[model samples]
Target: MPVLHSAIHKIDKKPDGTPAVLFLGGAEQVESQARDDLMHQFNESYNGTAGKGWGFFHAESGAFPLSGWLGKYLAGVGDFLKFSTIAVEHLVRLMEESNLTTGGHALFCHYQQGLTEYLIIALVQETEAVTMTEELSLLTIKRLDLDHIRLAARINLSEWKGNPQSKQYISYIKGKQGRRINEYFRDFIGSQEGIDGPSETRTLLKAFSDFVESEDLPEESAREKTHALVSYSMAQAKLGEPITLDELSGLIDEDRPKSFYDFIKAKDYGLSETLPPDKKTLNKFRRFTGRAEGLSISFEAHLLGDKIKFNPADGTLTMRGLPTQLTEQLKRATA
Candidate 1:
């Protein structure tokens, strides 16, 4: 529960006469002491209101709403700050009063003004190890490492200075990377009047790529789930490792396109996944010219001694066992 909820309720007669609090929850001794302390603090306040914001004339202050303390947003002298709406209201007032810059430039200036630059880090905390390629870079590796990245990520996830939502934000961080990235979200989004650019959210994963290149996915399986899996896996893949079949299956839908011939031709040459025949596994490979047009490449082994092998019959790539001279021509052209 938030500090705001600490207040007890009661019914009252009023000028405007609206619905009123009918009763108060039973208060413990500690709460009573806290209430008295708040009252004393309010009496000692500079404004004598013990409250933030401009609404009250002379607040007999005893713990104002969290929104009240959001008035001053001096995050640092030269820093971009993500603030709550109340803080932004103060900013709008300041911007309106200033005559120095245009709106676009002013906002940009505010964003770039932060003292230290930060990064948002996200790690698949509970996810299994996955195959992946190069990690994305914001700056040169010469300038940072995993520790630096993690620390920068932490700063990004920080939340409201005096609100309970900040605790919720903290709970989202399961480990170092997740927490770091969470920080980035808090600082970057909390203070903004807008969203970040498309490039900011861009990510890549090899397991997903391998999955798309795999032979199992159905022709009409949902693609959205595949996209999300790829995104999540990419963040967790081991850099410089070849994606495994099992790993690939987990990250993308097993969508084999409807047309078998087109699927084979497209996936064989396009994806570079080796197609071999097997009784148990799904058969999706094709050869343009062969004894078994739709047969798996592994089955071609049984017929190897009798005629032209499927591997050598790879249309125009190899210059042998072809009715036409297309492969010969390509060889000649390259030569």
Candidate 2:
């Protein structure tokens, strides 16, 4: 990663209805190996985190307009330090208004990976821990709690600039369900949810299933393709990247590179060219297949506990609601 600029500022606040304090860093470029490592680790954690929302920035207005400030910085009107200072001040104000108690060191990094540029903003907290020194003596230290990143957002500068009409250029961690505590952080960035990750993932899986059935692929071939799909999606999720349909199609079958892509296009599944994979939904997706001397069975893993029951000891499966065609065939044969 090539870091164009990076800085860290501190915000001191408590949920006890008190004023928040802001500590700004100097306006000098802070580039170091430690910074690189921190950015890399942060990217890994952010990529692995689930339940992120994707959207574009809100209109640039109000007391602390983030998009306007970012525009000035990007247009060469001010240095990154100036930009971050204004942004953190806005965050402090918003935190106060939201009555949020949590505060930490806010890190702003502008970096380039491959041909794409990105801006990552995260609020990191520190935890105290005991460690051993070179002499084997115990020592107390403060370390960044990267494992529990709550408030963070990354902007795809390349996409935002190149694709002016795109809505998923910004991705952010959206706390747990039924909680709006992180809404303030999103408002600070001026982003609204534009893409439903889970729904999109489900659609993709459904399209893949339809493609498999249409192809009339053997059980082994179907299983292999399913694995390919999941593996590619998970890898993209791990890299904080979206799954490109054409690219995924190529990966799924090199022999017929455009087979899946063409299938999806013909079916009109309403999928975007690229999709943000939902890890949770992907984790729940599985296909179970079995073939014996003269029997064949296949079903989605999710239906096991509901529509289908299995007995491991007896090596038997009890399925409800057989296909209408199969039911008619059995009825005719018995009659």
Candidate 3:
């Protein structure tokens, strides 16, 4: 009840656009005072303990010994490892729910920057645990470890002026082997297909990736849903009518192109009068387009203007992007 009451209080708004005061249980004066005191104490205790080894722990004051704070933080790798494990679990769940599999040489990555670094750490740990699976280098290991890498960067930029050991670690990362590792990180993070890629494909991939993360759905469930959609699209393509956005939106189901175009241009609550979609809705459309495009490319399907058309009346989509070779393959698969 306390948690629920707390949530209600956070959500409740007054008519004057201010937060509404919520009394715990009732309007009892003694209970309300106690509750307020308890919340204040809890917040203070949490703040005191939260960033013990981080610079923010003493941010209220004028303390700015970043290296000192960061050094203390580096001593607590075990605590960080536990939290990273939980984060990785959630990230994997998200990937699975998005119908994404981490295979191949790890192409088509769509990880958040933090997760990208965390994965590097996990890989470094795995390499250390095994015996000579490949040639090993200390600089490579450190580069993959964000804390070590950041410490080096800070020291190089003359920001880390703390412990002598921190200086030594940076010196090591700048050594012969370390230079290569540093270059690798720079390329990986900066490339178009990497964590900070600037390509539209990357953006679409990230949008789909985020959708799964936010939904927190299971991989098998997402796979099933996508499989149904692909089958529907393939069937429509085979019938020579294909599926249009209107048909996809339940406007019409007739096996004809004109029917789809007509349904969309019907005017009343149809495509002609539809407003622009919100960002979220637009992203959904983009994701669908990307997925279909990926499938088409894989199947050697045609996707020129001749095959896929867009009607200006309602911005409706009509697609037959699957290639003839893929169509035959799909028929064989179904048979």
Off by over 4 Å in 1: 1-89, 97-197, 200-202, 205-207, 214-335
Query: Residue by residue across 26-67, what tens digits does model 2's lDDT show?
Result: 764567888889888999899999989889988788943988
Summing lDDT over every window of 10 consecutive residues in candidate 3, give the lowest-scoring window: 103-112
How would you encode candidate 3's per-residue C-alpha lDDT over 1-335 as one tens digit per residue? 02101110111223353423322222112336554443334323322221011111122212223233234434554333233333233333333333322211110101122211101111111122223334564332311121212211101112122322221112111223344443342222221111111132223223333433344445454444344434554343232121344444332223343433443344222221111112222223322322343232111122334567669899665767565976999999999
RMSD over all Cα atoms, model 3: 26.4
Model 1, 1-335: lDDT tens digits are 01111222222323243322223224321335554543233222211211111111112122222123322333343222333323233333332333212111011111111332212112111112334346643432221112221111112112233432322211112124343433333332232212111111121122233333354433234245444444433332212111233343434433532333343344442322211111111111111222245532212222344454335456422223643565778788999
Candidate 1, residue 18: lDDT: 36
Best by lDDT: 2
Give the TM-scores of the predictions, in the order they appear. 0.20, 0.93, 0.17
* List of clashing residue pairs for candidate 3: 301-323
Worst 10 residues of 2 by lDDT: 175-184
The model with the greatest TM-score is 2
**Better candidate number, 1 or 3, judged by lDDT:** 3
- lDDT of all predictions: 0.26, 0.89, 0.28
Off by over 4 Å in 3: 1-69, 72-307, 312-321, 327-335
